[model samples]
Target: DSIRVGDSLTSADRPVSEPISTPPLAPPTLSCLFGANNGPLVGQEGSIVTSSKIRARLISETDNNVTLTVESCIEDAEKTLVFGRGELQLGILIEQMRREGYEIIISPPAVVTNICPDTGKKTEPYEEVVVDVDAEYSGSVIDSLTGARKGVLVEMMDDASDGKTRLLFEIPSRGLLGFHSDIATVTRGTAVVHHCYLDDREYAGALGSKLERGKLVSCELGKATLFALASIAERGTLFVEPGDMVYPGMIIGEYNKVTGGDLEVNPVRAKATTNIRTVLKEEKAYLPPPKRLTVEELIGYMNDDEIIEVTPKSVRLRKVELDSGARERAARVKKKRLQAQMQKKK
Candidate 1:
């Protein structure tokens, strides 16, 4: 219907709007790499291949578990190929797939690597990173990129107005896993970063984990109590408030640097009602705000044995094996492997 210059549509004349607005279709992510979904599939393990641009290859399947290598597509850096893309994407995809009647498990994002046939050397993905930061924070950016992230300085210019500095680096894609949130912290939230794939390069040496100290893991599943948090406050920084929900194996806080190993304590422990005097004594105690890490920061916090569980309702940092016993077993196995390697080096 055509409207005259000043004409207004009445309620009856207007088109009916649905209660929930339809969300726009999502643009493809930078790139996606899927692995570590070792769970049984209900349907014939073949639909995801035909319905979308995702590429999947069945690694193994049995009555109990199905493993697949799923790759996501996106325009490459040169805009020449859609061969690369995901940690958050994978988690969200798996959650959506489950909602859509599929059974799957997916791991966090990781750098995909290939071997150079001629040299028989391992090569990993690299990225072209462009960072714009305040002149004062430029040094921190440069140090972080060039030293910790295995980045090579491409260029640095202070030509921009407003005391801004521009930095360019070619860094391993893996090095960027948790850099987004960290740069902000280092620069006091004064840095702007942009990055994309830059072909595979020679393998960088082993990089260290992001966590400087061990984490505070919740031993019991329940809402966190203030008394419990007060008890744990001296242990390390809490990542949850007094009333937040926590589950077994979920990380609730950081551990003291001096005592560095995952410490399991009950966040959900209730204060005994008989201790009113003690409560009053402890009530005035200052509780530092817990850290609110994003999915990327949580990714940084991950050890090889942990996973960040993301869903529509919540993002929970959890051990890969929820069972405490299983995690300990895995840790012991890892320690033995490390010891054996050290012996070999000796």
Candidate 2:
């Protein structure tokens, strides 16, 4: 008689499937390197801290997810690097770690490109996208994908019976970054999109940024006040609720579509209520629900000079330089560097 031992059965010996084979590791299609979170809230909520702990967690990730690879930076041993198939795949790991009480800071996802030694041509990853949506929304979807993302529709099939359309496009891997949420919104949460690697293509011209609006930065450090949020809500969407902790350089919201500059608001300012006027006389504070950015959304929303601070309890965005004067000075230096590079190219 066969007896159960742990998850398997064995008396003398029971027949079982042969040992599973481990495939050779393949180079990642895309990769993004991330470091430990060193923000103002570091170690406040997360149990896991220190470089050794972060490295151990990342090593476990690569061991389980074969497609992922982890390496240490040659220059900085404290910094850990992760390579993966795509932004979503890597972002999933970060989200999981955060949920498990690990705090880490992530850099913006960068496409892994190659350059030909002889031809001097740059190459980047591409993906074959298959999308299905209602016929009525097809036009808008097509326009959006093709116009801004530089996607080429290879084939379109219309099913009159169901009034649905199927679209196939060969798009750059970079183009698909953060495009998922937009597709859902455009299709009213009904679009079904799938993508797979479609070989690398020659470098294309620079595509525009996904985020067109500027972020709302905090100018003070304290718990957010309802009165302050009410005034800030008119400027753009809020990311924090009343009594939420905020700090200088922390991003509180997005700017209005028409407004171009980054707005610095004091979210902790309190209202001066006169003794004579009752609380009922004050205008009702009705602030819209803050837009809680998901991992993918946060990756798409980040700028070159910004960092995403992740904790066990929350995910927040802030500038690299917290002081306003320092931030502006850094911007000037960046601009100068850009101008110098442009001149060198010329």
Candidate 3:
């Protein structure tokens, strides 16, 4: 007789067959999940708008998907770890979640590491990096990767068609930070980089240093005028145009000259007007457009002492030590500490 769990089954006039038993399905090993953020874009695009809804959807996903598992982590309130194939696979999941109208806070993608219990030693994940780029770009890629202290080039192959080269390296997770932008700039958007996990290994030395230059800061808050930018642009590249919002301590752009110590210029002040007017028409002013930094660029460009402020609508780069006086004080203290450590080693 066929019977449902909740309903009663009655016997018919004809003989009934015995019920058949089935084995339970095993749970899935793979899982895909997302995290939360306080960005303004949340709740704007999807049916599951609330955080709770998002959470529920994730939990419900494991119901029929026997191979997958979902659970919350103990460390962070706003984070969830979804173990899956690799970063590329996880990246696809993140894109889907975002398209569904969920605002998320994604830390730069990293591989989960483990410790060897017997040796009590730390180990990290690594990847095989394959880069194909123009011959000119090969040097910059090598320099950049080596600077990051991430990987070593294993081989190089020449591409005869366009005078390009293919380079391979074994890179650590930390070293790959911000490599995307660097590759784009070096190859002029012609390089192709592919990477996947290789194996666990001992920690590599410190990755390359952060940006060496200081920001072009603004001293006041107001609309930027052409005259103000003209003067400031002489110091370095300008990040703002005339009539743009200016705030004190805001980084306007990067400087072109490396020798000049950190320079800060006010962009809000207007040009002075003259009382006496000439008969000839006033000369027109032309200003160059400023370079805008995206989230990835801001992250890649920031120094260890800085943090990238990410909001739904905007991304701003600010010093970790917000106050100028405080930042100077911290730098001095850090310098003294490093000097003391060096002396101790001697």
The prediction achieving the highest TM-score against the true structure is 2
Q: Which stretches of candidate 2 lie over 4 Å from their true place?
A: 1-27, 209-211, 257-259, 273-280, 341-346
TM-score of each: 0.69, 0.87, 0.66
Candidate maximizing lDDT: 2
What's the CA error at residue 145 for candidate 2, in Å? 2.0
Clashing pairs in 2: none
Clashing pairs in 3: 28-66, 28-67, 28-68, 148-208
Between candidates 2 and 3, the one scoring higher on TM-score is 2
Query: Model 1 over residues 1-346: C-alpha lDDT tens digits?
Result: 2432333345776655643344432222233323322211113332332222222222111111212233333432211111224344444444554444332322345566789998999988788899999999998898888876788999999965689999999988778766777798899998888876677778998875344688888888778987788889999988899877777878787899744788999988876676335434445545888887765466555666676544334455666677789888988998999999999999
Local accuracy of candidate 2 as per-residue lDDT tens digits, 267-341: 999998665855566568888888999877888667777878787788898887789999888879988999999
Q: How close is candidate 3 to the true structure, as a TM-score?
A: 0.66
What do the candidate models score in CA lDDT, each in turn? Answer: 0.63, 0.82, 0.63
Residue-by-residue lDDT tens digits, candidate 3, 208-288: 665466678776767788888887887777767887665655677777766454566778777678898889997667677
Residue 2, model 1, lDDT: 43
Stretches > 4 Å off in candidate 1: 1-106, 208-211, 275-286
